[model samples]
Target: MSGAPIWIGAAHCVSALGEGPRFHLQRMRDGGTALRTVPGLTAKPMFAGLIPDELLPAGPRRIQRLLDRCLLELLDDLKPRPHERWLLVVATTKGDIAAMEQGDAAASALPLLGEHARQRCGFGAQPLVVSLACASGTAAFILACSAIEQDRYDHAIVIGADALSRFVLEGFASLYALDAVPCRPFDAHRAGTTLGEACAAVAISRDRDRIPEVIGRWVAGSIAHDANHISGPSRTGEGLLRAVQNALRIADLRASDIAAVNAHGTGTAYNDAMESIAFERCGLSDAPLSGYKGWFGHTLGAAGLLETIVAVQALREGTVLRTLGLSEPGVPGRVNAISADAAVPGRMLLKTSSGFGGCNAAVIIEAES
Candidate 1:
C-alpha cells in the first residue's frame, strides 16, 4: 500500500436506496432493505431492488441517463482539462438491453454505451468496455489501476450499470436462480438473488495534482477463473481462493492484516457456500465479513462497484456493515460472519466478487491514514 497513491479522485452512485455514495452508506446503516416486491414480467410478484421511477427520467434510454448522472458529477469534481488523458471505461452485463428488448433493430453494438460515455464526458482517450458477467464492475476498476500504473491513461473513469429488463429477469428466472423474496447473502435460510438496478463510478489517477480529493489507493487486485461451470461457481471455491490469496500477496499483506471482508454474497446456495470455503482457505476465518446484496439486491454488473464505493466510506469511518439477512452463520466454511455491524480495527478492506462463467475477482482497498 506504499508509493504515490492513485487518488480516488471522485465516486458517485444511484441505487434504489437513493443517490450519492455517502447517502447509500447512511441508508445501509439504518438497518433496512431497500428492495420491495414488484410484479415480475408476469403477474407474479417478486422482490427486486429497482431505482425509484421518479429518480429516472421519463425516457427509453434509462441506462444512459443513470450513467450520465454519475459521470457528470465525477468530471465536475475532477475538473480536468479538455485535453487531459482521461479514459472512459464502461462495465455492464446487458448494455442498453432495453433498446433491444423494445424492438430497436440497431442496438446490437455492445460497445456503443462506452463510446457514448466517452463523448458525453469529453474523455480524451478511447473508451474500453468490459462484460464479465457479474464480476464486470470490479474487473473494470482493476483494469483502471493497471492502465494508470502503465501510463496508458492519466486518469480512468470507470462506470458500471445494469437495469432490470424483461430479458434479464426472465433469463435468471428461467434458470431458477432468483428468489421469490429479497436476496439474503450468507444466510442459512437464504433462497436466491433478487435482481436490482444501479449505476456507480470511480475515478483513478497516479497524479495527485490532477485530483481534487484522494480516496485511498487501490492497493491490489486479482482475477481468477475456475472454468468449472458456465453459470455456476466452483463447488470447491477454487478460483475465489486463489483470487483472494493473490490479492493479499499483491497488497504485500497477510490475511490478518485485512480488517473486514466485503463479499459478493449473492444469497444463492452455491455462491455462499463457495465463498465461505474460499475465505477459510485464505486464512481469513476471523475477519468480520458481510454482503451488501441484501441491501441493494443483486445489481449484477453494478454490484461490485456499488459495494466498493460504500466500502471506501466504511473503511474511512472505521465501520463494518452487518449481513442484513444473516442471522445464523450457515456457510460451509469457518469464515467469520457478522450479524450486527461493528467497528473495524484496521484500514485495509478485502472486496471479493464471483460471477458466472467461473469468474472470480478480489480487490484490496486501503483507507488513507
Candidate 2:
C-alpha cells in the first residue's frame, strides 16, 4: 500500500496556560507557568491546571458545548474541502466521566460523543472514540493517518479531551501517585504527577506540498504494550525502546539524527527512570529532552496530542520550554531539562508516551520543508 502524507492543517488547545494556539505559544515563550494548588482534595497539596469550575459547563450538555466551542475554533482555522470525506476521532480515557460523577444524566454512553461531533462539526462520517489511556491522543493521530492512507478519508479531525473527575482523582490518590503540588518531572525531589484537564484538536489531511506543508512528517509510529503490569511501566523500558526503534527504523533514521526528545516524564520515580533508560537504549541519552506535564499537568488522554502540538511549535519556532518542575536531575545520565534560551534547529522531534494497561506509543515529527 502507498503511504500518504498527513498534513496538520491547524491545531487548537485549551490548557492551564490558556486557550487557543496564540495564548499557549505566548506562555511558552514567556516561560510562564500555571501550576497551582487546588483546595479540599486532601491534606497533601495537588497542583493542576484545573479549568476553573465556572469555565467547565455544569452538565453533560454543557461539556459537549465546551467541546463544540473548541471544534468551532479548529474549523475556523482550517476550512477543509466540502466534498472530501471527513473523519472525526475523539480520544479520551474518561469521556464525560466528570459529569457522571456529578450525577448528570447524559454522560454515560460513548455514542453521545459522536452525536456531539456530528452536531458541532457537521462531520457526517462516523465518529470513532479511542480510549487507550494516556496514549489515546497520539494513537488517535496515528489512526487518522492510517485511515487517510487507506483512502478511507481525505481529512480527519483528531480531538483529545478529559475533565478532572472524582473517579480519576481518587484512583490516582489510591496509587499515591498524585502530587500534592506541581509535579517535578525528572527532578531529584520529584514526588508524583498532577492531573490536569484540557482539550486539543488537530486537523490532518493527505494533501502534501500544500500551503502549510506538514512541518512535521509522521514517517512512522507504533503503539505497544508491556503486558506486564497495569499501573507501572516495564522495568527494562523494553516496550518503550521497541517503539522508538521501530519508529526510527521505519523513518530510515538513526538515533544520532534525533535532535531532541519530548518525554512522557510524569514526575514519578519509575516512569522517569524507565524513560531515561529507553532513551539511552535508543542512543538518545545526550539529546536535549523536555516534558510539558509539569506546566500543563498530565492531561491524561490529551497529553500526547497537546504535547505533540507543542513539539510542532518547537520545530517551527526552534525553541522548547524547560520542564517546569524539573531540576537536579533525578535520572542519572539523562540530560538536564531545557529551562531557558535554548535553540535547536534542523532536528526531528521524537515524542513518546506511556499510559495505564502498559500502553505506550512513540511518534517522530520533522520540521516543515
Candidate 3:
C-alpha cells in the first residue's frame, strides 16, 4: 500500500438544495441559495436551510433515510467490489438528535447510530463514528484515507449526516450564534451563521484503474486544536493555521500550489476573522478564497465532506466557487475572498474546517492525475 495511489472513488450529497451532486453543483453554478425563513420549527421564524418536506420524509428515521440514500448510492457505484475488509466511517455532531429531545438518550447515543448504519446498510463492516463538532466530517475523511493508505482496509466510505433538531437549534440560539438572515461569509455586515441539514458520502479506494469515478487524490490531511475555547475559535487562528501548514508539508507542496481555499466560513465574526488571519499567515492572502455556508448554510457535521466534493469539482473546472451573499470583504485581514465565481486555473484545492472545542482540520485535494 505504500506505493498504492488513493482515490476518491465516488461522492454524493443530500441537503436543502436537493439530492445527488448535480442539483447542488448546478445550484452553486447559478449562484442560487437554499436558505429561507424556516418556520414552525422554532418559536420565531428562523433563517435556515431545511430539506423540503417533499424531498425528505418527516420522522425520527430521517437520519437513517439519509444514510440509506447516500450510502446506497456510493455502494452501488462500488459494485463487484468486496467490502468485508472495507471501512465505514460515520461523521456527525449529534446522531439521532431528535431522539434525545424525545427523552430517548440511549437511541441518541452516537454508537447506536453507527450500529444502525451498519445494520441498515447491511454492510459486513462495523462502523466508526467521528463526532468532532463541525469538523467531524473532515476528521472522518482524513482517517478513512489514512487507513486505506496504510493497507488497513481495501477501501473506505465516509458518511457525514446531521439532521436539524430543536435541541441543536436552541443550543446555538443560546449562544446567539444564529443569524437573522441567510449567512454572508467574510462579509463585514455578517452577523452569525444559519444552520442547515445535510448528508454527504465519499468512497476512497486504492484501485485506480477500475475506478473512473475517482474525482481526485487525497493528497494530505491534518487535525489540530488551539485549546482556546469550547465554542469560539482561536483569535489568532493558531490551530487552523497549523493544520493547513501540516497538510501542505505532508503533500510536499507550497502555499502557492493551492488553486483555491475551500474554507469553513460559518459566517460568524470570529471564525471568519480567524480564517482570514490564518490564510494571510500561510501566504495565501492572494488566493481565491470561497465559502459554501451561504449556498447550503452551515451543515454542521456534513459540511466538510459536502464542501470537499464541491471543491474537487471546482478544482477540475479550474474555477473558484463564489462566496455567496458576500458583498464586502471584511474579516480584519487583506484576503482575496471571492465575491463572484472566478477562474483559478490550477489543479489543487485547500479545504479547511474548524469546529467546537477548539478543533481544526485541513485536507488538500489535487485533480486526478
Candidate 4:
C-alpha cells in the first residue's frame, strides 16, 4: 500500500517534566525527575507525577478546563486554515474519573468536554472520543491519519488527557504495580510503575510545509489484542511481536532500518520482561532502546503521544536522553540499558507502546528534509 504523508504540525505537552517540548527536552538533558509520593493515596503505596495543585483547576470541572487550556494553546500555535474543517480526536483512559469520584457535579460536567470545545473554540467540527485503555493516545493518531488518507478530513487534532484518580490508583495498587519510589524501567532493582496526570495535543496535517518535520515518517502503526488476560500481557509476547512485525511490514521497512526504540517500559516484572523478549524476537535487540516512564511516570492514555513527542524531539535534536532511573539490567535479553547521551543520526525511529486489555501498538516515524 502506498503511504500517505501526514505531517505533525505542532505538539503541546504537560507532564512531570513541565510544559511544551522545550521544557521536557531541557529537563531530560538536565536529568531531573519529579516523581513524588501522593499522601493519603492508599495504604498499598503509590507515587505519582502530578500537576502542581496551583496549576490544576479547582473542583470537578477541572479536567475539562485543563484540557481546554492545552488544546487552545496548540490551536493558537498552529492557527490552521480558517476554511478547513478539522477532525478532533480525543483519547483518554480515565476521563475525569477524579471528578466523578467527587460526585454528580463532576460526573455530569465531564461529558460536556466535547461540546465545551466546540462552543468555546468554534472548532466547527464534531469531536470524537477514543478510550482504548492505555493505547488510546497512539490509536487516536492512527485514526486521524487513516481519516486523512481516506479523505475523511484534511486535518485532525489529536488530544490525550487523563487526570489522577483514586479508583485507578487503588486498582493498580491492588495489582501491586505501584512503586513506592520513582519507577526504574528495565533496572535490576525495578519494582513497578508510578502514576502521572497530564494533557497533550498534536495537530497533524497533509500540508507538509506548515509542519516542523522530524526524522522518520509515521508510515504505519497497528493495534492488537492478546485476548488472554485482562490486565496481564501474554507471556510469549506474541501480541507485541506481531504488532511490531506488522508495522514494519506495512511500512516496507526492515528492523535494521530502525535506529532506536522507545520501549513501553512500565517497570513491572511482567511488562518489562515481556517487552524485552518481544524486542529480541523482532530482531531489535541490538538497537539502542530507552523508556520515558521513569521521567514522567506512566501517564496512561497520554503516555503514547507524550512519548511520541519526546522521540520526535530527540530525532530533531539528534540526541537520545538516558533512561532516567534505569540501572543494572534485569530482564533476560540483549536489551541495552545505557545511560548518557547517544547520537541517533539514523533515518528511522520505531516507537512502541502496550497497554492493559492486552492491547499493543507500534508506529514508525521518519525524518523529513
Candidate 5:
C-alpha cells in the first residue's frame, strides 16, 4: 500500500450550520452563520456556535450524541459495503469534560470516550483517540494515511468532535480569549476567537475503486512543533512554515500549485499574525486565504476536519469562501484574505491548522481531475 492513493469515500460534518457537508456548504453560500449569544457554563452570556436545539440529543452522554449522529448519517449516506478490516480514529480535545465536572470518575478519559463511541457505532474494535488540541483532527488524517500506506486496514473512519462544556467555556474565559461578539478573522480590529463545537467525519480507503464516491485524493501531509510556548504560537511562524513546506515536498508540489488556502484562522491577534508571516515565508502570500472561525467559531478538535470538508466542497464548486469577519488586513505580511466568495481556477487545496503547545499540521487535497 506504499504508493496507493488514499481516497475520501465520504465526508460529513454536523455544526451549527447544518447536519451534512452539503447542507453546511449551502448555508455558507447563503452567507448565514450559526453564531449567537448563548448562556455560558459560567454566569455570563457568551457568544457561541452551537448545534440547533431541534437537532440535539434528548438523553445524557452529550459528547457521545454528536459522534453517533455523525457516524450514523455517514453510514446511511455513504452506504459503504462492510469491510472486514476497518479502523476507527476519534479526534477530540476534551471529551465528556462536563461529566467530569459533575464528578463522573472516568468520563474525561480518552479510552472511556473511545469505548463509548466504538460501542455506539458497532465498530470491530475500540477507537484510537487523537487529542493534540486543535490539530487533533488533521493529525488523525496523517495517521490514517500512514496506516493505509502500511496496509494496516482496508479502510479508516476519522471522526472529530467536541461539545460545549462548562469546563472548556470557563477555561477559555480564564485566558481572556473570548470576543464579546462574533469574531473577525484577519481583521484589523480583530480581538479573539469565539469558541465553537462540532462533530465531523470522513471515510478514507486505499482501494480507490471500492469507494462509493471520491471527493479528492489525500496527496500529502505533515505536522511540526515549534515548542515556543505552552499555549502561544511562535512569533516567527516557524512550526507552520515547516509543516507546509514538508507537506509540499511529500506531495511533489510547489507553493504556486496551490489554488487556495484554508487557514486555521482563530482570529486571535497572535495566531492570525503568525499565519500571515508563515504564508509569506513559504511564498504563498498571493494564494487566496480565509478562516472559518467566523463561520462556526473555533471548533477546537473538530476545526481541522470541519474546515477540510468545507474547503473540499469549495474546490469542487470552483469557489473560495470569504473570511466571514474580515474587514481590513491587519497582519504585516501580504496575506490575500478574501472579502467575498471568489472563483478559483485550480482544484488543489492546502488546508492547515495550528493549536496550543506549538503544534502545526497541513494537508493537500485535490479534486478528481
Candidate 6:
C-alpha cells in the first residue's frame, strides 16, 4: 500500500441508463428500472439494458463506437503534460465479438480493440487489454494504480466497454442467468441478472494539484481468485473476504471506517448471498449497502468502472444511492441494504466485485477534502 496517491481526475459513461455518471445516478435515485423487455441481439423478448442506437456513434463496428464515444467525452479538456507518459488500459469481456460472429475475424482479438483506442487517444504506449471476465474493470484500476505507483506512467486512462453480442447473451442464457424482468438484487423474489451494454472511462493521475477537483483517491485495491468454479462463486465467500481484508490493510482503514459498501449484487441467488457473507465476514454487514444492477443491468466488463464512477459521484454529493429493485431482504447476513437514498456522514467508501472464474476485487475510495 506504499504507493503514490492516485487521484480520479475525470470520468464518463455511456450506457442504457444514458451517458455520464450523474445522469445514471439520478436515474437510480428516481427508482425504476432501465431494463426493458425487448428483442435481444441474440434472442426475442429478453430483458436487457440496451444502449439506444442513436446514442451509438455511426460506425461499422458497434463496440468501437461505444469505446470512442466514452473516451472522447472522458478525455475532453483532460490535457496531459508534454513530458508525462500515459498508459491506455481497456477492460472488456467481449470486444467487437459480435462483429467477429459476423465474419470479421480481426474483431475477436483484443489487440485490435486496444490498437484502435491507442490511436484515438494519441497515447504512445500500446494499450493493455484486460479481459478478466467480470472483474476486468476493477482489475484495470488495480493495474493503472500499480503502474503509476511504480513510475511506469504519469497518467492512466482506464476504459471498460462491452456491447451486447449474441455470443455473450447466448452464453449467459444457456446458464439460465438471465432474469425475465428487471433484476431485483437481494430481494426475496430475485430471479437473475439482466445483461446490459455500456462504456465507462476514468482518468487516474498522480498530479492532483493540476486536476484540482479530485473527486476521490484510490486508497487501496486488492484482487484474489478462489479457483473454486468456472462460473459459480464459493459458498463461503472466502476469496472476497480476503480481498476486502487486503484492501483495508493496504489503505490502513478498519471496516468500521467504511461509510458505505457497494456490493456486486447481480441479483443471482448465489451472487447476492455470497456478497452478504463476504461483507459480514469483513465486519461490514451493518454498513449502508446497495446493488445497482437494476438501474443499468450488469454491464459485464464495464460494471466495475461504471459503478465506481457513480460511487464517486455519491461521495462528492455526500449521499448513498438506493439499491434499485430491492424490496425485501433474502440473504442470511444482516446487511443494511439501502432501500432509499440518504445522506451519509463519512467520506470513506468501499466498492467490491466478484466475478466468474472466482475472481474478486475490492477498492477503497475517499472523497477529497
Give candidate 6's error at residue 144 in angstroms. Answer: 0.3
TM-scores vs. true structure, each candidate:
0.96, 0.92, 0.96, 0.93, 0.96, 0.96
Give me the displacement of residue 208 in model 4, in angstroms.
Answer: 1.6
Error of 2 at 148 (Å): 1.3
How close to the true structure is residue 363 of candidate 4, measured as C-alpha lDDT? 83
What is the Cα-based lDDT of residue 139 in candidate 3?
A: 96
How well is each residue in 229-277 modelled by candidate 6, as lDDT tens digits?
A: 8889998898999999999998889999999988888999889988888
Residue-level lDDT for 207 in candidate 1:
79
Candidate models: Cα lDDT each: 0.85, 0.77, 0.86, 0.78, 0.86, 0.86
Q: List model 2 lDDT by residue over 93-126, tens digit each.
A: 8777756766875766666776777667776777
Candidate 1's TM-score: 0.96
Could you give candidate 5's per-residue lDDT for residues 210-249 as a string of tens digits? 6566788888999999878988899899999999999999
Cα lDDT tens digits, model 3, 237-339, are 9999999999999889999998889999999999999999999998899889999999878999899999998878767777788999899888977789999
Q: Is candidate 2 or candidate 6 better by TM-score?
A: 6
Q: Give a tens-digit lDDT track for model 1, residues 87-174.
A: 7789999889888877884784668888878887876577889899899999988988878777777788889999877788888888
How many Å off is the CA of 188 in candidate 5? 0.7
In angstroms, the error of model 3 at 294 is 0.4
- Clashes (N, CA, C under 3 Å) per candidate: 0, 4, 0, 8, 0, 0
Reference-based lDDT, residue 80, model 6: 59
Candidate 4: C-alpha RMSD to true structure equals 2.3
Off by over 4 Å in 3: 57-60, 80-84, 210-212
